[model samples]
Target: MGKIFTVLLVIVGFVYAKPEIVIEDPWVRAVPPTAKNTALFMVIKNVGDDPDTLIGVKTDISKMVSIHKTVNQNGVMKMVHVDKLTIPPNSKVELKPGGFHIMIMGLKRGLKIGENVKFTLIFEKSGRIILEAPVKMK
Candidate 1:
C-alpha cells in the first residue's frame, strides 16, 4: 500500500505540473464580413529555463496567419512580416495593437462579437498550444 501511494503521488505531480509557456488575455478583434484582414493580440510569458521560438499559427477563420510587427519608417507606419519570434527564457512577449501582432488575412467569414476564434500557437520547443480567443473591439 505504501508503494502504491508513492506511485500515485508521482503521477499526480506530473499531471499538475505547470506549463513552460503561458498565454494571457488572448483575443481577436471583431471585424465585418467585408473586412479582409484582422489581428490577434495576447501576452505570452515564458517561465522556463530554455528559450523557445514561436514558429507559426493556425486558424480556420483565415486562409493564413503570420507574425507581424508594426514599425515606423520615416514618418509612415508600416507592418512587416516576421519569419519567427524568439521568446527568451523567463521573458514576456506582448502581441498588442500598434506593436508585434498576429495578422490573419483572407478571413473566410466575419468574426462576430462575443464569439471565439480557434487559435493554435506553434512553438519550436514547447510544441502546439491550442486556445479559443474571444472577439472584442479592444
Candidate 2:
C-alpha cells in the first residue's frame, strides 16, 4: 500500500507541475557600448500538455522590445519583427543568436556584464513567465 501511495504522489507532482519554461543558456553577446540595439538568446522548454504562446516581452533595460527572426532571403540575411512566438506542448523552442531572438532597441544604458536583466514573458495559456537572464559577454 505504501508503494502505491508513493507512485501516486510522484505522478501527481509531475502532472501539476507549473509548466517548466526554463531559459536555458541565456546570454547576451558583447556589443559596443554605443550600440543602440542588442539581442538575447535562450531556449524555452514547455513540459506541459497544453501549448503556450509567447505573446509579448517586457523589459526595463530597453525602450523597445520585439520578437525577431533572422531568415535568409535570396542569400541575404534579413531580420523580421514578429508579434508572437509559439511553443508546442511538451516541446522546446530555441531562440539562438542567429535565429529567433529578442531585439532590444534604444538601450537606457549599456548593460554591464554579470548584471541580471529581468524579463516578463506573457504566454497565451500559461499566463506570465518571469526570467532573470544575466548579461554575458558571449
Cα lDDT listed for each candidate: 0.90, 0.84
> For candidate 1, what is the TM-score?
0.84
Q: Per-residue lDDT tens digits of candidate 1, residues 113-138?
A: 89988999999988999989999987
TM-score of each: 0.84, 0.82
Q: Which TM-score value belongs to model 2?
A: 0.82
Clashing pairs in 1: none
Which ranges in model 1 have alpha carbons more than 4 Å from their true place? 1-19
- In angstroms, give how far residue 117 of model 2 lies from its true place: 0.9
Model 2 lDDT per residue over 1-138, tens place: 999999999899767755556558777655789998998889988887666788988899889899999998999999998899888778999998778999988889988888888888888777787888888887
